[model samples]
Target: MDPTLQELLDGIGPRLRRIRQDRRLRLEDVAEATGLSVSTLSRLESGKRRPTLDLLLPLAGVYRLALDHLIGAPPTGDPRAHLTPHRADTRTRLDAVVVPLTTYPGRLQVFKQILGPTSEPPVLVTHHGHAWFYVLAGRVRLLLGDTERLLQPGDTADFDAGEPHWFGPANDRPAEILHLFGPHGDRFTQPD
Candidate 1:
């Protein structure tokens, strides 16, 4: 086996023993819960026996931990999604940066949008989704289903994307907002 791999495997015994001790469990207790013999459990913990899935799985269940946790798996890398900010429009001075906030592919997506001065008028368009926007800085102009509203900093709006809606900087100034969109008409409900 490769040295790194061997080192990882060697550490498993000590980790297993530590976790068992941390839980104030003895080898006999673990054996009783995992249906493993006390001697087998002890040998595994003492590195006399190599750890295997058959052994680790039952022990993990008894310890209420994931298999990786039992083995002390190293992190693959940072779990956070890398934020890539992109301009919404390049031809116009109406600068807008859209940064995706969600990592997984799903019906509900989130974005942090920053809009600069817009010389053109707001063009309303309709689509199939539910949208919620929270203004974080400056002011925003929201046109939804024939109604128009000016949202200031800290203001929020939730509406069906199927309705004709448009939003941008309220005036010739910059604005930042958090936008949550559900492509399949998913609604955002506050947890009870």
Candidate 2:
């Protein structure tokens, strides 16, 4: 076996364990989701069984990760991140496109968002998290409870997500923003 291949294979076991632990998933939970037995998962994580495509495919789905990232493949020296934008408004009728900026499990998630005016009145929602929004282009209107504010370029707002809040373009035109959402008990670090 090539030395590089051996090294890559050796690292997969630890990476699997680390990803599972980082996502706060238990072995039983993984087994149930991936349809792989707990003992098999344990052996795979312990490097007793060599990883095959069949084993990794389901794990990748459950973890919401690309195969390359899952196995820690060497980077292709590409500076650009081939990000896929996903819809943010699944139930609500808000028109927005969200490109995920970070993918670390069980941690703060960041996104670049583009939003359009809403036809219906904005719906305020509450969730267990903290969010910070920064306007990158155009204008964004933020409605939190009874308070309403229009944010322009370079403007920022950080608030408790527990408060009823919804935000989108202030007018008919589109707006762009950099959004950061941190889950419950997420502590943000500041550079010294």
Candidate 3:
């Protein structure tokens, strides 16, 4: 292993100990919370034992620390900013460009979506966030909740993601659109 990696692993024990002490948590408490023996926790904190996923996952959950922070892995290379376009099943292609407008208590994310001819509607997935979309060209079929509408060029739509929503090409031609996804209770805006 690289010296840097070794050094990082060596320091995790002390870091874990410091974090635990900072939180005023006892080894026994952590052990009980994580189903680990107190001696095993001590060995882990003292660097006598290498931490593994089985050990770290519970500790991370208990301590409220991300696994990456717990293990001190080197920062990954820049998250690729450019999109890797996905071609649809029906001669259609999409380029989803992700843009973050702000990073604060709530994150605002945006995507520029382009769809080619015959793009089929993708399965609707529900996750944490609200989304809004605007069609710039061609037609878009918006499936939100129980309602489905065909948005002509220059049309726009928005809705809560929790209620389930999906969008794709409405015809045999390609379509292009801009989508904004807000996590902080922000609504989508469109021209009247």
Candidate 4:
């Protein structure tokens, strides 16, 4: 194998171990779930044995993760974005189609969000970032702190995410919006 491939393979053991530990799963539990022996799983995590797809597929399925996620594969250098719209929650009719408008490791990230009517009341959450939201379609009900506002098509709002906030479709219809956020909690300064 090439040196680069060898290095990638060498890193898989630690990554697998970390993922298992992060999920708080015991080695025996993973073995039972993956139909792999505990000794085999231990050897795989400890780098005593090389990983094969036969071993990885079952482990990935048991961990509820993609094989690429398990191995920490580098992002493919494709320029175009592939957006897969999936159900965000089982209880609500909300479906999220997320498209990353920026590359990884960027200070600011942009997302195009589509939210369907929620079945439950919105739960406000506070975090440490600044966020901007621009409604593209339908009406969006934004709950920012004690203020409640309805945003129509082309409406925009920006605020510190430290404030209690939540948003969704104002009616039974779907709402599409653009969201931009600073990962490090940096505020977006408006242009003069």
Candidate 5:
């Protein structure tokens, strides 16, 4: 076997551990999210298990990184970002595709969300967080408490997640937005 290949393989375990810790995700959290057992993750992180595509793919998604980047592959000159897209579960029957934009551990989670038109009525829920979203395309309808507003491209909104709030497409077209949120009330921007 090539020495470089062996060295790369050997380094994977520490890399995985570092990334997981950097993301502030516990083994149980990763297990629950990835459906991988805690023991498996431990073994992988401890260098007792060999890395494979099936195992690394989900980890890459969880870490919001490209497989090559995650494995410490040599950098190509390509500046394009590789992101994984997943559906946003809005509790009710809502259509939203969430693509993470940033992966700063324990910091604000940034995502580009595309919310499709939903025939169902909006259902608001309360939580402990603050969310700021900027509309990038189409139209968005933000229902906050008893008030609702239709937002267009370039419009921005921020609110306490504790408030009963919900967002959806303003019309039949899907609405796209850049969403920034922190579940622990971490403010991304200062008040004007």
Candidate 6:
């Protein structure tokens, strides 16, 4: 086995023992719950036995944790933001998410907005915040009540959510934009 891989596997045994002790559960109790032999559990926890799916599955259930959480795997180098995306409507490819949900109010909430060509008529929604958006690549057609304009790449726009508005891709193409939503009472204003 590779040195790093061997070290990683070796560390899990001690972690398992620590978690079991922290939970104040005895080997016999865990064995009875998981239907695994107490001796086998002890050997596995003591690093005398190599960990396998058979051992890990029952152990994860006993500890009330996912297999990945129990093993402590390293994170993948994904460039995508950590935001959990949600679709507003299938007709309009409006993908959005609130960043750092527990963050303090008034701080900027970042979002990556992707709108498809079919996304239109903006279905103006009311919310308690202001928003500023910058087009990253494609064009975003903004409909702020009577005002309508096409924002091209590198263009930015800001507006109050209280104002009825709608937005979608211009020229029937997909659009990507970065939005910074502000807290209540902070009205977004465009640079004149």
lDDT of 2 at 125: 87
Compose the digit string of candidate 1's lDDT tens values, residues 46-136: 8999999999999989999988778988756556766899888633335799998876566688899999877887777888889998999
User: Worst 10-residue stretch by lDDT in candidate 2?
Assistant: 75-84
- Looking at model 6, the pairs that clash are none
**TM-score for candidate 1:** 0.56
Candidates ranked, most accurate by lDDT first: 5, 2, 1, 4, 6, 3
What C-alpha lDDT does candidate 2 achieve relative to the native structure? Answer: 0.89
Per-residue alpha-carbon lDDT of candidate 5 for residues 1-192, written as tens digits (9 for 90 to 100): 999889999999999999999889999999988889999999999999999988999988888899998989766665454488999788756899999887666778889999999899889888888999999999999999999999999999999999999998999999999999997997766789
Where does candidate 1 have its weakest 10-residue lDDT segment?
86-95
Q: Candidate 2 on 151-176: residue-level lDDT in tens?
A: 99999988888889988889999999
Cα deviation at 49, candidate 6, in Å, is 9.5
Q: Could you tell me the lDDT of residue 61 within candidate 2?
A: 97
The C-alpha TM-scores of every prediction are 0.56, 0.56, 0.44, 0.56, 0.59, 0.51
Output the better candidate (1/5) by lDDT: 5
Q: What C-alpha lDDT, on a 0 to 100 scale, does residue 53 get in candidate 1?
A: 96
Instruction: Compute the lDDT of residue 127 as modeled in candidate 4.
Output: 81
Which candidate wins on TM-score? Answer: 5
Q: What's the distance in Å from true for residue 77, model 6? A: 19
lDDT of each residue in 30-126, candidate 4, tens digit only: 9989899999999999999999999999989988888888898877786765564444552223456666666657578777888877678778888
Stretches of candidate 6 exceeding 4 Å from the true structure: 1-42, 45-83, 90-107, 187-192
Between the candidate structures 3 and 5, which one is better when assessed by lDDT? Answer: 5
What range of 10 consecutive residues in model 6 has the weakest lDDT sum?
95-104
In model 2, which regions exceed 4 Å deviation? 1-81, 185-192
Query: Which should have the higher TM-score, number 3 or number 6?
Result: 6
Residue-level lDDT tens digits of model 6 in 6-97: 78898888888988899999999899989999999999989999999999999999899888678775555645555666655533335443
> Total clashing residue pairs per candidate?
0, 0, 0, 0, 0, 0
